[model samples]
Structures are given as structure tokens and as C-alpha cells.
Target: MEKDFKEYITPPVMLVVLLLAISLIFVFPVLNMIILGAILAYGIRPIARIIQSKLKFESISIILAMIAVLVPLILLIAYIVSVVSGVLTDFLASNPNFDINAVLTQASVYVPQLSPDNISTTIGDIAKYVANYLVGKIGSIANISLDLFILICSVFYFVKDGDKCYNFIKSFVPDDHIEFFDKTVESVENVLKSIFYGHFLTSVIIGIFGAIGYTLLGYPYGIFLGVITGILQLIPIFGPWPIYWALAINDAFNGNYPRVAVVLLFGFFLSWVDMYIRPAISSHHADIHPLILLVGFLAGPLVYGIVGFIVGPLILGITYVVLDSFRKELTESK
Candidate 1:
């Protein structure tokens, strides 16, 4: 043990370790995006391979796959954020024609504990905070642009050469531990599939269904509400409750009793659809517990911000399976 420690602590090895630490420190700020890019590459790599099989040019295939898959994904996220923020900002901005006082008065009738004046003041404070935050973020446009470029490049290269990276990492694993490494890799893949299909794919399906149902129900901002529902579906605990509940309550306040029952029924249906879709998609994969995902989704944003939504679940799932693999290995070795 002494001999091995001395060998590992040689001058050359010490230099390498020092440089590696510095490199990590340098990239610490945007490490979240870099890690997220690597996770996303797992999904994009398969598509790139399929296209390369037909195109015969690796680089072009990756670019095409990114355009097909990643671009739409980025656009979808941007659209949701921009549209929601814009709509809220516009609605909150004082306009002589719009009377928020009347709406709050009606709301107070149902929830007497909530005074109309207090609600109005709270909402005014929130609107001011959101407006100020948006204005402040505007100054960081360059940083956003830089992160976008890094994410794209990271995905592209990771897709094109992920095998090389995998092999490079595997080379460092001792022969006796190769089995453990392989099991961990398999676990990682399963986690990715579980998240991509169970969370994201299901979100898309629910969102589309919501848009259609709300439009049919004749809500004013039906499509917007549907998009919000779909986004809500990504959070395991939230599901579609907020959107449908708000609609139902609004209908009730307006004395539309029949429509209230109809919307509530539709909301329950959406919730039921989620129960079916998540298990059906996730079962064949890692079959991670809902509680694990719930914790990940809730805690991830606090740590990693927006990208945490994707990174949090994947990281937790991967970590869970990796530890499980290690436990099995330890038992078998005994």
C-alpha cells in the first residue's frame, strides 16, 4: 500500500491532478449546461446514428439530427417561456379597458379569507418583481448566447465521438472491475430512456391532448392553458391539477355549473392519462420510483435552475442504479 501510494504521488501525477483541479474550477459556472448537454447527447446520439446509416457522412448526420431533434426542443422551451412571460406581462400592465378589480371582487366572494384589496396588492408586487427580473435578465443576453453555443457544440461532439469517450473511460477501469463498469453503463442508459420517454414524451402527449380538449371546451386562452398543463405534467406531483382547477373555479364563479362539472371531468381524465402513460413508458426502462423522480424534479431546480428539470432526474436515477449495481457486485464477490 505504501509503494502504491508513493507511485501515485509522483511529480508527474501531482502535476496532472493540479491542472485537472484548475480546469474544473474554470468550468464551474457553466458546468450545469455542460453536464446537461452530455445527458441530452445520449438521446441525440441514437438519432445521429440512424441518419448516418443512410447519409454515410458522420458530421453531417449529427448536424442533421440536431436540427431535427434539438432545434425543435430548444424552440419549444423558448416559445413556452417567452409566450407565458409575455402574456403575463401584458395582462399585468395597466390598461384602462381591463378591470382586474372586478375579477378579484368575484374571487373574494368565494374565498372570504382572501380580501380583494390584499390580493390586488400581492399581485401588484409579484408583477413588479417579475417585470424587474425580466429587465435584469436582458443584460445577460451575451451570457445566454454563450451557454447556447456551448450546449450545441457539446451535444454535437458528444454525439459524434461518444464511443471514443466511453472507450477512453473504460480503458482506465481495471480488468477485474470491467463487469461493474459495464453494469453501471447499462444502468445509465436505462435511466436515460426512462426519463426521455416517461417524462418528456408523456409531457408532449398530455400537452397536445390538453390543447385539444380546452379548445373544444371553448376556453379563451385554451391553447396557452394546454401548454401550461403540459409543462405542469413534467412535475410528477403537480400533474394537470392547477390548470383544470383554475378553469373549473373560474367557471363556477361565472355560474357556469354544467361547464364546471365538464371541465373537472376532463381534468380527472388528464390525470388518469398521466397515470397510465408514465408507467407504460417507464416500466420497460429502469422503473424508477415516483418518489425519487418527485424529489429530483423539486430539488433539481433549486440547484441547477431550469436545466435541473432534465439533469436532476437523470442524475438521481443514474446514481441510484449505480449504487444498486455496486451492491450486487459486492454481494456476488463475497
Candidate 2:
């Protein structure tokens, strides 16, 4: 009985327990940042490797890759923020009084139960709620910064030592199970890459076209609305329709019937781009069901906030692969 109990506390078992504990500790606090870093590392690893091969230095390669990736992302974010700020400033300037009642009255035409008389109090309540929310978030700024720093450092290390990390993980699995594990990892990687490439590329294409269309039509904040439309493309089944339709409604209200028609036509075209582009890019790599991706995007943010968008789909994909693998194993056993 004593010998059996000692054997039960084997090295593998102990290591697994330690790993589980470490993962549990990180999951709630910094798992999202770590995951994001891992994803970035995976995406940029090829570039990093190529640079490493030429430069003969892993650190130099990682630094270059980080610069190459981060600089554009930073610029894009800055541009979007500036554009959005400009649009808000213009809106406030144009509507100097910024009457909540007038906006409510317009909306009440569609939502018949909306009382224009109560709009002022409703607006005040909403403003107070938003202010309180912002105040609450202010307390988390330091934590957010720390997470961001961790994320950056993790990405660098992951990119530099990803293969070693992968090997270390592989060491834990039995030799017989290693092949299956590798397949699962490969499948997950393909799914993630496909999702990133297909969705991002499609969004960019639609946004650029929408921006050009809006500019030609002399719409205010053409670039800003276009950028928003691009982000909205992340949501399945309702990509950019709300924004375009709202613009169309505004045009209709202004009696610009021709511009409304043009907006509708362009909007329809932009929406169709997803149907063509997403399948072409994503389906080639992984046969992920559209429904799975939809659920991941919709439920992910709900559960994990912003990080859920990526994490949600990933979890679902991994779950799918695991189930499928087990099914295969069962089938083979029979």
C-alpha cells in the first residue's frame, strides 16, 4: 500500500498538478494578455525567423519584428482615434445647443412609445451613468497598463523562443499521444490564422471602399464611419448594415433620395464582399463552421469582454478538435 501510494505521486503527476496550479493562478488575472501575446507571436514568428536567419541574432530579429508589427498598429489606432475625435468635435460644433429633445423627437417617430417630453431627464440619467462607468474604469488604468506591459514582453519571448516552449510542452505528453497532440495544435493554429486573416482583410477592403463611396457622396465623417463599419464587420450577420442604413435614413430625412439610393447600393455591395472574401481565405485553411465562428464572436465579448472576440472562437475551435479527436479514437478502438 505504501509503495503504491508513492508510485501515485510520480513525476508526471506532480508536474501536471504544478502546471494546473500555475495556469489557475494566471487564468483570471492575465490569461487574456498572455493569449493575445501568443497569438501575436504566432502570427509574426515567420517574419521574426526570417530576420533571425539573416541577422544571426534572435534578439535583433524579435526587435525588428516587433517594430514592424507594432508601428503600423499604433499608427492605425492613432489615426482612428483622431478621426473619431474630429467627427465628435464637428458634431458638437454643428449642433451647438445639442438638444436631446430634438434627437428623441426624431427617434420617437420610429419608436412611437418614446416620450419626447422625458428626453431631457433620460439624457441626464444616461450621462450620469456613463460618467460613473468611466470613473470606475479609471481605477483599473494601472492594472491595464501592467497587463499591456506583460503582453508586450510575452509576445517578444514567445516569438523568440516559441519552438523551445512548444518542445517543453510536448515533453509532458506520452510518445503515443504526441502525434495526436501535434495534429490538434496544427488544426488550432490553422483555425486561428484563418480567422485573423479572413476577417481582418475583408474588413479592410470593405472599409476602404465604403470610405471612397462616402467621400464621393459628400457625406460627413466618411473615413470615420468607414472605419466603424470595418470594426462592425466582426459581428456576423449584421456587418456594416446598421451604419449604412442609419446614413440612408438620415439622407431620407433630409430628402436626399438619390444619395440614399446610392448609399443603399454601395452598402449592399460592401456586405457582399464578406461572402466572397471570408470563405476564400478562411475555408482554405480550416473547415470551421460559420455558426461556430458566429457564436464565438457574439458570446466571446459577452463573457471575456474585448479579448473574448479572439479567445471565444479559439476555445470553441479547440473544443471541436478535442471532441473530434476523441470520436476518432473511439471509432478506431472499435
Q: What's each prediction's clash count?
A: 0, 0
Candidate that scores best on lDDT? 1
Q: How do the residues 1-334 of candidate 2 rate in per-residue lDDT, one tens digit apiece?
A: 9999998899999998999998898776888888889988888888898998899988989989989988988987999889878878998999899977777788889886676866667778999999998998898899889988988998999988888999999998898888788888888888877777878778888788888888888997788788878878877777989988999999999999999999999889887887888899988777788888889888988987888888888788778867777787678879
TM-score quality measure for candidate 1:
0.85
Off by over 4 Å in 1: 74-98, 102-120, 215-224
lDDT per residue for candidate 1 within 77-105, as digits (tens), equals 88788877887788778564777667778
Which pairs of residues clash in candidate 2, taking residues 3 or more apart in a chain or in different chains? none
Each model's Cα RMSD: 3.5, 3.3
- Each prediction's Cα lDDT score? 0.88, 0.85
